[model samples]
Target: MPAARESLLDAARTSLARRPWSTVRMVDVAALAGVSRQTLYNEFGGKDGLARSLVRRETDRYLAGAERALAEGGLPAAADWTVTRARENALLRAVLTGCWTEGLPAPAPTAAPSTSPVPAQRRADGPLPTPAEVIALVRDRAVAVLAPATSTAGARATLARDCEVALRLALSCLLAPAGDGGTAGLVREAVAPIPYGAGR
Candidate 1:
């Protein structure tokens, strides 16, 4: 059942690349997924439900990338990875700002969803978080994940502050890509001062 739902979402995402979400149809997605229209409805309820699921799936992918980068050892590494991913994934940029624009072409139909385990279930009816809210969530999670690496109370406090700054720097570069030093250079410079903890 999970695989079937994933296939449907993949088809929907592929259709979205060629046209706006308003024009995407359930029949086409079902056909692409080799499932019946009823099955599609059963899986996602309707088009809006499907879209929300897609957004959540994409957001999860972005967060998974951030988690991996954080695991790579420090705040600077996390900043670099986050900036690079935002630049590469158009869906990430769109979800971050709640503003969709033409950016990178959508992934091919065969592309698979991220293999990272899904996080805790979210309420289906809640509205998606705004860009600022998303950043704050990231900041909080980063501090929680990285806090144990710090040896002193002062260093932990500083680490939390630096995580917030690093995320903001990455979001800034994503929103208005730097023309002079480039996004990577700018993000790295901003996060370079944060002390990295021993990998937990």
Candidate 2:
């Protein structure tokens, strides 16, 4: 079932590349996934369920990539990842920027499929985070990954602020690409803490 579910979502994403979600037929998605339409309904309950699941999967993947980027090189790397992914993934771009644009499915709250046998589908049907919520989630995730357990609350707060600065810069870079052709330098400069007592 998991495999079928994943395949369906993959097929849905591929179809989305060619057409709007509103026009995508369940039969086509099932055929593309090589499953019966019945199986599709059994898994997702309906098109709205599928759409919700698709958006959830996309956001989850994007955030996971952000976490990996953070682990590899902190905020600059994460910022770069965010910019790159937004450029390549339209759904993610919509999720981050609050612009659904034509052909992309916007995330929204949907009633959970109480009768769904698939737990994943039920979760997917739950209320989705808004673009603002996504921003907050990423900032918080950056803090959790960047700030260590030993760091004091004050230090963590400062780190969180830096994370927001980096995230905002990255988001802005997406809206307005840097003429310099990258996001890392901008994020690095924006988040770099001032040296203590430098003004003296």
Candidate 3:
């Protein structure tokens, strides 16, 4: 009776909570959701399709909150990143990491490393983007989103950078310990100029 997307999301969330992203099976999600495997395939096409939907759903929620807060000058932008950082914190990371919660013991602790091992740390060989460079990108995208004067190319570049920064921030939030708040302050700082200047 639920909408197809909501039903799919509910099933996907349950499966993700039980196991790592790689191990989650579409069949399991369909079973949990009470939908036939054919229906699941018809709706989502595949696991990758479902993952993208999940990402978009989560991102849409965050963006809605950001839009609401952005009304108070550029403060909303800062608030948006802060909220996003909190959502991506250790708790979410633990879920993402495929470690067991209180329930779902059959999977077992020794089922295999839930996440991939990182390659040896290495220095960057190319020109590195400074935080300011990253911020400029955020600003450009915000302008394109909020202001009609900014050109599409300018906005596209900025949007791309914002995405890059968001990924880095997500990683930091997931890896860092509690109370650190990850790179929230940095994201806030980066996002501030957009809303503040747009109203000028």
Candidate 4:
């Protein structure tokens, strides 16, 4: 059997995966993990702490995957950049979709979901890649993928930015919510200009 902390963490992950993070409570987590509330508190320092740990754990996994993708050439190499952005979207999506405002309040030990009535300071709806960051990630990786493609300094910069946009669009498509059309539409619009197999 997993240790208490591990059990609690796994329970939190499972619960969050099913319901919004705001819906999950420490009592619920303890019940699901088959541990005592005190055990959860002792290990996680309460709900917000647990949520932070969950985010950190997921972030670590994403970074590990990104590093590995960088090592392996091909689309997977570019996948490093895509995966980081995808993970951020997933986290943000969760916060946005799972909020409790006019309800009886979220279960104890957890902070009200970040997307509650107060609203998230960092809103979910925005440019997928923020343009600049994606441009940099792609440009740095481009030398490896686009070394053979002839281009002057200005041309290479333009190509890199376009490729980053293309990547962001692809990820947005892949990670779109099952029913939501916004991400899908954004992806379609963004990808129309970039040609594939042009970089690799």
Highest lDDT against the true fold, candidate = 2
| Poorest stretch of ten by lDDT in candidate 3 | 116-125
In model 4, the runs with Cα more than 4 Å from the true position are: 1-3, 74-167, 174-200
Worst 10 residues of 2 by lDDT: 191-200
Candidate numbers, best lDDT first, in rank order = 2, 1, 4, 3
**Which residue pairs of candidate 3 clash?**
none
Residue 52 accuracy (lDDT) in model 1:
66
Stretches > 4 Å off in candidate 1: 101-122, 149-153, 179-182, 198-200
Residue 145, model 3: lDDT of: 48
* C-alpha lDDT values of all predictions: 0.67, 0.82, 0.47, 0.50
Question: Compared with the true structure, what per-residue lDDT tens digits does model 4 show for residues 12-71?
Answer: 878876777767788999999998998777665567666655554543454444444544
Screening candidate 4 with a backbone cut-off below 3 angstroms (N, C-alpha, C), the clashing residue pairs are none
Name model 3 segments beyond 4 Å from true.
72-141, 144-200
Q: What lDDT tens digits, residue by residue, belong to model 1 across residues 42-84? A: 7766676677678777777777777677767565566667777
| Highest-TM-score candidate | 2
Question: What's model 3's overall lDDT?
Answer: 0.47
Residue 72 error, candidate 3, Å: 4.2
Candidate 1 whole-model C-alpha lDDT, 0 to 1:
0.67
Please write out the lDDT profile of model 3 over residues 1-200, one tens digit for every residue.
Answer: 23755787777877766676678888888888888888776665566556645643543444444444433433334333544544553223333333334432112122332221211101111122333443443444454445455556655555445545543554455446325343545555554344323322
